[model samples]
Target: MELHFMGTGAGMPSKERNVTSICLNMNEERGTMWMFDCGEGTQHQILRTSLKLGRLEKLFITHLHGDHLYGLPGVLTSRSNHGAETHLDLYGPAGLRAFVETALRVSEAFLGYTYTIHEVEEGVVFEDEQVRVLATKLEHRIESFGYRIEEKEKPGRLCHEKLKALGIPPGPQYAQIKRGEDITLTDGSRLKSADFLEAPIPGRQVVILGDTRVLNKTIAFSKNADVLVHEATFGQEREALARKYYHATAAQAAHIASEAKAATLILTHISSRYQHGEEQTLLKEAKEQFENTHLARDFWYFSIPRKTASHS
Candidate 1:
């Protein structure tokens, strides 16, 4: 899976960064893309990339903040124009349905496709054969939420050499053994499927948090995540101001990742105050706390690697 950052700025648009928006590309696995936090100018950012707006199947809003959701109307209209005739699922806070509906109504923007809005609570909001999405309440200025996406474990690899050694011919029976089904051979011997299959590889987990202050509970919430995407609106020097505004500093975000034992930490929602020369300092500060930390820039994409069973 790949995470494509359309916008990474904290509050408003700047010369260097836009607001908050990310597209999780699952086209290779699920033939669709999932979006998180559509901010202002998000569609414009998509235009800069090769992402097709019609492929966006789901939109998970974090909160009701203007900076987090101001781009929804435009994106929806554009998706309709781009021929997204199927239903689009939207999940967010309690007032999300009202906000989206009102904006579309007032603007008289008619969509060719139907849409479903789900006001989420702190638990599993979406699940299918391939993945499950869970949400937890975050400590922010408003009733914000953090999302954890869990990809289901894929089938284990077939041990072709083992099958050959067992004198199993390359036939339809090989398919049954790969599926963990025991079958009787031509010699009246029972073929054990387990011996021909490798151990199941574990699924990956991605935690994406909305704007929030550093909370101790996050450590457990994000435990062992393959990728933890957290907002770093300021540096350690501005901790006091960050807390007052219900935002986290770069050092704090790294600390959370370290405590959670997350494999990687991506710091986004950067403040525009840090100009070209100064932005590197934020990444440096975060790396000091957690070596696996990375600063997110606009239009950057992160590919999440799968964890094999042997590694665990």
Candidate 2:
């Protein structure tokens, strides 16, 4: 899996950054992509990457904030122009459906593919065979939400050596045994798969939060995340302003990462006040609390490696 950061700025666009948009590339696992927050110009950003609109199967909107959703209409329109014919699923808060419907109705934009909109609350909003997504309300000036994406555990490798040692011939029967099926040999002997297979490999977890202020629940919401993507809209010195604006500071974001024991913390949604070299200031502040923290910039993409035993 890979995470593509389209726009990393908070509130508005800047010369260095756009607004809030992210894409989770699941091509290797599912041959599809999932998007989070489609800020203005997000479709343009897609042009700079290898992302294809037709492969975007799901969109998770955190809130109705313009900075997080202004690009939806254009993106949807573009997807149709690109001949996207598969069904698309959208998950968001209550007003999201109304907002999207209004935009499409007013613009008269046509989508070649069918789509479904789901108004979500604080609970499991989506789940399939490979992954499950959970949503929870966040403390923002407006009603916002955070998402936790969990990849389901994968089956362990079959102990081929063990099976061979037991005089089991390798053939189609071995494939069935590897699927955890009980097998009866030609000699009327039973072989149990559990005795020869390793433990199932635990899957990775990713937590991405929307615009919000720091809260104690943040730690619980992000517990054990392999990658915890949090917003640091302000610097440590702007704690007062952060609270008044319903935002979080870099230090506070790192604190949550540390408390949650996240393997890596990615800070984004930077306020435009910090420009150019000034970004290091926020990075420094966050690193004081969480050592394995990185600052995200627009157009930056990260490949999420397999979770190590320590991270698991």
Candidate 3:
């Protein structure tokens, strides 16, 4: 899976960054893409990338803030204009459905495809055979949320060489063995499926949070995440301002990642006060608390590699 940052600025757009939009590209795993937020100009940003509107299966809004929203109508309309007929699912706080419906109604926008709006609560918002998405309340100025995306464990690859060595010719028995089912040979000999399969591959977990102050629940919510995407809207020295505004500083975000034992920490939603070169300061501060940290830029992509069998 890969995370594509369409916009990374906080509150408003800047010359160096847009607002706050992120796309979780799961095309390789599920043939679909899930978007996190859709700030203004998000459709414009999507035009600059290789992402397709047709593949956008689900959109999860963090909050009702304009910076985190305000682009739903345009994105939906554009998807329709592009002839995307697949259904779309939207998940967000209570007012999200009303806001989206109002915008579409007022603008007289028509959607070619149908969509569903789900008012989320603090629990599993979505689940399928391959993945499960959990939502938890965050300490933001408004009713914001953080999402934990957990990929379901996959079966290990079949040991072709071992089966060949056992004189098991290629047949329907291969599929049975791959499903971890014991099969009886033609000679009435029992074959163990476990002996012909490698260790199971563990699923990956990704945590993406909305704007918020540092909270103990965040650490627990993001435990052992493969990638933790947290907002670093201020520097360490501005902790007072961060707390007052219900935003997190770079160091605080890093501390949460460290406490959660996250594999990688990605900081986004940067304040425009820190210009092009000054972002390094935030990165430096976050690195002080957690070494494996990355400051995300607009259009940046971070790929999360799958865990190996041994690690599982």
Per-model clash counts, in order, read 0, 0, 0
Pick out the ten consecutive residues of candidate 2 with the lowest summed lDDT: 303-312
lDDT, candidate 3, at 207: 98
lDDT of candidate 2 over 49-130, digit per residue (tens): 9999889999999989999999999999898899999999999989998998999999888889999999999989999989
Best by TM-score: 3
Measured against the true structure, the TM-scores of the candidates, in listed sequence, are 0.94, 0.96, 0.97
lDDT of each: 0.92, 0.92, 0.95
Models ranked on TM-score: 3, 2, 1
Global lDDT for candidate 1? 0.92
**Angstrom error at residue 181, model 3:** 2.3
Best by lDDT: 3
Model 2 ranges off by over 4 Å: 308-312
Residue by residue across 5-110, what tens digits does model 1's lDDT show?
A: 9999988999999999999998988889999999999999999998998999999999989899999999999999998997899999999999999999999999
Of candidates 3 and 2, the better by TM-score? 3
Choose 2 or 3, whichever is better by lDDT: 3
In candidate 3, stretches whose alpha carbon ends up further than 4 angstroms from where it belongs are none
lDDT of 2: 0.92
